[model samples]
Target: MSTNRELLFKYRKEGISDAVIYFALEECNGFDHLLLSQNLDKDIKDENRFVDAMNHYINGEMIEYVFNKAYFLSKHFYVDNNVLIPRQETEQLVLNSAKLIREMFGDKPIKIADVCTGSGAIGISIADVFKNNKVVLTDISNEALSVAKKNGEGLNNVSYLQGDMLEPLIKNDEKLDVILCNPPYIEDIKTIDEKTWKQEPHLALIAMPCTLFYEKVLKDFRRIMNEKYLLAFEIGEDMEEALTKLVKQYCEDAEFYFEKDMYDKTRFLYIKSANSYTNN
Candidate 1:
């Protein structure tokens, strides 16, 4: 029988970070750290679960997937292998969109759509924050949509649509005040690490030509978007110049801006129609 400290030391020696080890323990035991401290030398009760989680981590599996839950905007969202795990950087998308909605819509009910909504983290979090706004979460994969829907089960204002980008909106004649997307921007699937390639869904990770979805949306944007609309995207850093060109060609009347993430890398795109924005 191995003691908790001994097992943790083994994991540490295998290059598992302290944060990941601690998170795994907390997830398994649910914050009984005092007992954990006193019983450092005691045999762990559910040692097999810990072993399995650590083994998965050692094999390059994401901790969030091991726990089957991810935290976004300070809320816990259910996640699975079927969908991409929520990322910390995407929280900015929720924040930026929410702020713009409040400032632009100003208490009026607004329609928003989150295209390529994986796990519903972006759309659902925005809907959760803006209680008065209705959000439609759309994805091309039915499996991904199922995960998104599960995460949004408690929210009344959130709906799910399965389709490619804005196609469902165009088919349904739905017009939106805001459209947010975190589409597949990885230009090469080979560039992804082996663990990610094996564990995550390929459809959600690879975007051949890299800008296909963005280009598609821009071409058909007029069909589903209102006169005054905001388009927010989580883009790859390498996409800034090309995306700027796309905006110039298609969004001639829109003001486009690229925002930097915490590392100062340009990773977010914000395009707002010039004619629609009037200071309230």
Candidate 2:
């Protein structure tokens, strides 16, 4: 009820939406200025704690990481320093997955795999909707796997694994019906990508040298993916051409799709297995 101006300075870059902060303050009941400042580790005590927090966030610490949470598929998801913040555009990926599930398997239970499962957002959201379906969450980083486990702690019919690309998934014997991946596709664009991307964990965003993660995942797909499966991925707008080319390496019969997000950004990729689905 204060609406104090001092509170506004706490968030400069608008790193988080105002509504989320307000909701967190109300539901969590811990938005005291003094407590926020004192407990906000290394976040400056100046007029711009927001900027200070941003810097630490770049270094990968939680700060007022206190109020950090996201709503995916109309449900709340808790995220912290170890996890990459879920993007609004990612909801499209989940929606597309749900649509595919409904289309292919109808109301019957199906199997799905979410690769590069950061915080388990996509898989968890999908699993929440298709409660009877089996959803497997896979991530390479132990820290990220821990975050995913936390996100999906109580969910039934979901499994978690830690391994590279398609490595962990082989344990399933390649019977997964759907493969959902938001792999690191932000290929190194020497100039533009550096300025905004330096903030996230290099491991989560970068895909090593010349090979982007999406390409690797797809190339491996022809070998690892089930004969009757679909793969959906969150993609970089400018990199779709590059991605299509990557998908071709393994399966020329693959279907390429451009999914537009809320901001009208083409932020998603969909590929139907050649052995599974006809071009549609």
Candidate 3:
């Protein structure tokens, strides 16, 4: 049986990063990096599974999908090829939205929806934080929703709906105080790397013109949103001008702005209704 240290050295020699190797070892063996490091001489738990996971990684599968898990806002979410993996920028979206929610609504219970919710990461994370708020997650893909449902299993404040964008909310007569979305915003499929293009779901990617989903939701915003509400989106870095135009076209009287992620990229778009409260 190969010991943990031996496997680590083996994979590291084969060009895998320590981060990937540690992640795989932790997932398959239930030992985090610290524990694995401390017990390097111990035989790996489920060595076959670890090897299989490494094989999948070597073959170009995303490490998150290889293990069916992803971390967002420091919370673990079940993920698969059916949904786009949660990203750091999207975590920024959630954090900023959460902070704004507290600043805007305080402890008052509000209805929140994460449209185009893949893996239920955004909605589930927000629901976990704001236990007083009600969160609804909507995804067009049933398979994706299944993964989301699995991640959302314990959250009492979270619910799942399957539909394209905001249609399910409209049909269900759900009016939300805050709508958060990380829709498919890539215009050119060619811009994505070969590994991502091959491994991730195109339905959650490849939005022609990049603003396709944004336009759809903005066009029908009134149908699903309350009179006083906030709309947030994870946008492409280059989309500020076009999305500004799109938001103005649909929400002429609303206040909206673009926010930068940790990497300083303009990656989030936030729109507030004319009646919504502002700290200023």
Candidate 4:
């Protein structure tokens, strides 16, 4: 059994980032940051598992997938290749949705849906924060939904439905106060990096013309939406023009706008019921 300090020195020589190495070590060894700092001479119990994780990382697997965990909105989510790993930009979408939810309906009990919820990250985060609200997580893939179910284990306010986007809601005659989505919006798989294209699930990444899913959602927006509602989407950076056109065509009476991410890329689309806009 090698001491933690010796294991760290050996892996650090592999040129991996200190953050990545530390994260892998802590997760594999069940060591918190304080434990890691205070007990460098402690023996690593599962050195082989740590080595395997490092090998996966070195072979272009994202650390999130290698560890089967992703952090979104300060919550840890279980993830696998079956689901798309949550991204930082998606975290922004969650933040924006929460902010708008509070702004539009403070302390009002509401129903929220995370359409195409991959790991249930967005909906689970919202449900965790807004205990008064009901959250529905819908996904098309059973395998993906299984991963989401694991991530949502402790939340009493969340329900998981397996179906195509919005179909479950429509079938159930469910009307929601807020609808948040981060659907697959990639225009061309070839454009994505080799590692992502090869490793990430394509069903969660690629869509023909990139705006197809958005159009599908917008075309049927009113069918499953409450009279006063908000719909938010995490869109591809290049999708503003096409999505703006779709929203205008399908939701002419709605108030909608495109928002930029921290990088100043047009990465979010928001549409609100006309009455909601007037009330706010």
Candidate number achieving the greatest lDDT relative to the actual structure:
3
What's model 2's TM-score? 0.75
TM-scores, each model vs. reference:
0.90, 0.75, 0.94, 0.93
Model 4, 127-185: lDDT tens per residue? 99999999999999999999989999988999989998888889989978899999998
Compose the digit string of candidate 3's lDDT tens values, residues 103-177.
Answer: 788888999999998899889999999999999999999999999999999889999999988889999999789
lDDT of each: 0.86, 0.69, 0.89, 0.88
| Off by more than 4 A, model 2 | 1-17, 28-64, 189-199, 209-211, 274-280
Top candidate (TM-score): 3
lDDT of 4 at 81: 90
Candidate 3 lDDT: 0.89
Model 4 TM-score is 0.93
Cα lDDT, model 2, residue 244: 64
lDDT of 2 by residue, 126-190 (tens): 98889998999998888888888888988888899899888777755656778898887655656
Any runs in candidate 1 off by more than 4 Å, and if so which?
1-10, 32-45
Runs of candidate 4 with Cα error greater than 4 angstroms are: 277-280
Clash pairs, model 4 backbone: none
Query: In lDDT terms, how accurate is model 4?
Result: 0.88
Error of 1 at 154 (Å): 1.3
lDDT against true structure, model 2: 0.69
Compared with the true structure, what per-residue lDDT tens digits does model 1 show for residues 101-199?
A: 777777888899999998999998898888888899999999999999888888899888889888898888888899999999898777898878888
